[model samples]
Target: MNNEKYTLITGASSGLGKEFAVQCAKMGRNIILIALPGGCTPSLAENLANTYNVDVRIFEFDLTDSQELKKQITLILERFEIDFLINNAGVGGTSLITETSMEKIDQIMQLNVRSTVLITHMLIPHLLQHERSYIMNISSMAAFSPIAYKTVYPASKAFISSFSLGLREELSGTGVSVSVVYPGPIMTNSNTAQRIISQGIKGKMGLLSTAEIASTAIIGTITKYPTIIPGFINKLNHFLMSILPMELKLKMISRAVKKELI
Candidate 1:
């Protein structure tokens, strides 16, 4: 709220987004936490502000709402300096293309792709003003290969990967470091955990804690790594996937994910 610089993280009420907020606050950085309204952000703000003794401000808004999203960002820019941005608000699902609802499809696109791009596009100017700044867009291991059941989600993540990397090059040597993190499966909740567990060892191959993902991603972003795969298995998987033929890679990944529908 003061003249302080903060890290703005979307979807900060829970899951990986919350973990990023926690780690950033722990690093003694002020924070601007954003999530949909009618959430626990107020309480999370209180906890972080108390525990870390830093300025933790919370803005509750649906990123899908364009007008309000812009309004909130304007207010934030007017009030505080933000040197770091975390585009963590995204959703993914596994199902048949026909089974996916129009609303769900729109939400995924808006949150994962549009909102991320909008947030970054807006904050880049503010970030560049600082002597050093950072941007971290959360992609996924799924981004490396297109899976059958997760058609839209992976494509969206792939966009994030490409966008972040391209923007990193465009901003080369500007001291405004941009990075994309490809995190493996994160057991954010019981349902997600059950789904991953049901798939056995194959599902858990690159699984990492939300804390690990958040911490490692922050470290990589600060160190200016343009592409960060959080776990060793994910890195290896990325490499292995690179060697496979496109058709075979698509078929193999599709076959494995098709099991989720059963």
Candidate 2:
């Protein structure tokens, strides 16, 4: 086994994934950065490798393609000792259930859920052998709510949140740790702000920069926090949402969805 600890971040070519790659490198972690084929991150990988003076290996594949992911990851694990796995490759899709197509839902689930499950499943053995290991799944505040227009996206995040929590429990007795990041309106291309704004959602807020969110997530994962909700307001919102009655909460959320993003 390779002795050096490398951080493996998926979707690393841009947005939150790219930010994670840079921040992890700054912390002096060797990085296995995975980007979609032809995505922006390959060039960024070169920059990060030069600037941070950390070993950077780029893995390029379409995460939604199961065969491609398995082949690529198997090849990389032959040589890299991954200490951290960030299950962060995801896409956003927004449509009412009535308007959504099966094809779109499948695509979203394939990348956001199936791909995450498969990668983590494949890497668990390697992670188990590490003295200490961290797996961070990027969920969303939508995991706590049943979103309207953006129906399938929230469900995908909910899957991530539940999977991370269950995995955390399963790994409790071991050195491997699982962390879930529930970011609210991150200022990334895949975010609520765009869909909500375009739909005229009322009282919606601006989002955190990807760098800011990624920094917080990295800190939480490194510290082995079970869950990290990035912003103060988002944290408070989650706390309140947890206690609020479901009926009242759903009504309020439904109104907001119809008013803003629908």
121-143 per-residue lDDT for model 1 (tens digits): 88889888999999999999889
Runs of candidate 2 exceeding 4 Å displacement:
1-3, 190-193, 196-206, 259-262
125-229 in candidate 2: lDDT tens per residue? Answer: 999998899999999888898877777888899999999999999999988999999987754663545655654423345357888899999889889999999
Model 2 C-alpha lDDT versus the unseen true structure: 0.84
Q: What TM-score does structure 1 among the candidates reach?
A: 0.97
lDDT of 1 at 25: 88
TM values, all candidates: 0.97, 0.92
The lDDT, on a scale of 0 to 1, for candidate 1 is: 0.90
